[model samples]
Target: MTMDWCPGIREACAHWQNATMLQHTFDALQMALESDSDASIDAVKGLVECICRVIIDQLDDPTSPLKPKDEASITEWVSAAIRVLGRGDVRDRKFADLIKHHNGLAESLRVLRNDAGPFSHGKDGFIQALTIYHRRAAILAADALVTFLYKAYLDSQLDPISSREPWERFAEGNALIDAHVGLVVDDDDSTTLRFILPSGDELPINIEVSRLLYQLDREAYVEALNAARGAQKPAQVREQGEH
Candidate 1:
């Protein structure tokens, strides 16, 4: 079955291994995420390449500005893509910080040029962590670009970023949700398992595994959390009254 909505795109994973997968297309990449590994890097690279094509499709004229032969122009276009997402006005507040982050993300993409090193093979802890950082940046960057460029296409469908957060935490929170919920297959039911998204959409979920997603749906978890907090308030009041 074709998955309608996959929360795996913005998954929040503390460790790298939990966020990597060999996805079919960047369009399809939202369905699965783990971390950046040597094995998974090629897939993500392809995914980003697909997103680049989408960017072209999104543009009004879709020519010049980003020349394949020019790294400088490519970086400029990437900078512009990072801006005006309702994140910042570029001339207004957050300008300085935005440039800093924009530069950082662009610099991180530089590592994609090379596939050999401790970062690529995972020998050094620090470099490996840096590579993971860069890869995730690429993922989020591509995802955000898609969100901005293809707003009409994305809005009509159930896509990545199911839940929303504050603007400042948007990127981090979006990435975090990817790992929060996952599909858990039922061994007894080899034929099917009912997995419904909060939006009431359903899908096959896997190749052989008929599954009920194991993790808590975001809405349910939030409701349960609020209830637990509310439950505590009454207990605290009762103790205060007794005192």
Candidate 2:
């Protein structure tokens, strides 16, 4: 079967991983240090919202038995799905902290503006609070994703205790799902297993043999990854309107 959703998943993950919460925290701190700017507030709010949405979506179980196709928006879908999972009580703490921090900053900004007072100290305090809050939020989000994926994998398998660290297996599963590289072929099936590459092109080959050679030589997989990167760069550049 064609893995049509793999690209979308990869895009979402890439977006999530590209902007570390720490980086945003630093940016917020810098803006606070310079002056309380609208841009800094927006940046902090945006990061919190993005991480929340990502965690909520992953926890909602897209591959669930009751996966709804008619989710109108990520926010709505996450709101609805998170309810079913009963994750709100545990999940709400970090979210509430983020909200509180934002509200406090807004109030401080208002007070400073009204009083004609220097906003640097107040803004700096908000920045410090936001940094701690964002770090906690990021850790929570990552743990939620990893745990949710682990639980789903365990539920699907016959042996629930196959391994203690299911997150590692989950990571392996994701790579397999993306690269379409690994498969467990039955001895009864005489025909060779063929994995369709990501581009919907290229001849299929046995990934086991590829791995064996890769382990022995190390150069092959490096070359392959490099080639894949090389091939993708120009397309990305072109998409960005670069010459």
Candidate 3:
């Protein structure tokens, strides 16, 4: 059943942009960047920090799904930035470099998620534990994106006269399909270990990967939880009817 569950995490991540809390942060970041009266690059850094903080906060919630809509939130901000900063302002070489770095980070996150195994069978408890592991992995990727974006903004501030049109187009195209498809051999190995074992005389061969098992256990949990909740709901309805 765990194998059957499609990871809806991507969708959940996309939803934050529409959420009030995250939308306000994006608005503030946009306003700060648009008011470009100062040469200080701190505004750019502030934007990166705000984005990273929102994502980290969302990920901290164990029940949250990773939704593509959550990603759309960031993309929406990027689109708005293009309008405010102007296409040329974002297309500079420095901005290109920054986009490259953030793209790599986004790829890394995909790799880690792919390797983490599915949560179809895994219940909320198992997912909660896995969430702990994922946050550690996500932090590195998030940091790289934030730092690169800040630096790019700083570079733009220094060379406001530079041409950014080419790079802006390039970054927009890159962001769309920029994905990490790393070969997760370790995950494959874990699968083999889970389903296969070596046998020898006078020796016990047991393949154990606790994390994988924990994830599998979640499927068992979700099913039971759903069943229990379903049972309780009917009883509640009956009591209400009697009253």
Per lDDT, the best of the predicted structures is 2
lDDT by residue (161-218, candidate 2, tens digit) is 4433334436656666767644445465434455556666544445464565586668
21-60: candidate 1 lDDT, tens digit per residue: 3124532343334323433333444443433333333332
Alpha-carbon lDDT, every model: 0.41, 0.42, 0.40
Which residues of candidate 2, in runs, are more than 4 Å off? Answer: 1-36, 61-85, 89-220, 223-243
**Model 3 — which ten-residue stretch has the worst lDDT?**
1-10
Query: For every model in order, what is the number of clashing pairs?
Result: 17, 0, 27
lDDT of 3 by residue, 1-243 (tens): 110111222122233445554355444434433542111122222333354444333222336433234445443443333222233245689876765555555655544443442332232322333443354345435445544433333333222133222334345434543442212224445533221212322322244544444456877667766777899999999999999
> 1 or 3: which has the higher TM-score?
1
> What lDDT is obtained when candidate 1 is compared to the true structure?
0.41
Q: Which stretches of candidate 1 lie over 4 Å from their true place?
A: 1-24, 27-37, 60-77, 80-89, 112-243
Instruction: Give each model a TM-score.
Output: 0.33, 0.29, 0.25
Candidate 2 has what TM-score?
A: 0.29
* Candidate that scores best on TM-score: 1
Query: CA shift at 61, candidate 2, in angstroms?
Result: 4.1
Model 1: how large is the Cα RMSD against the reference?
19.2
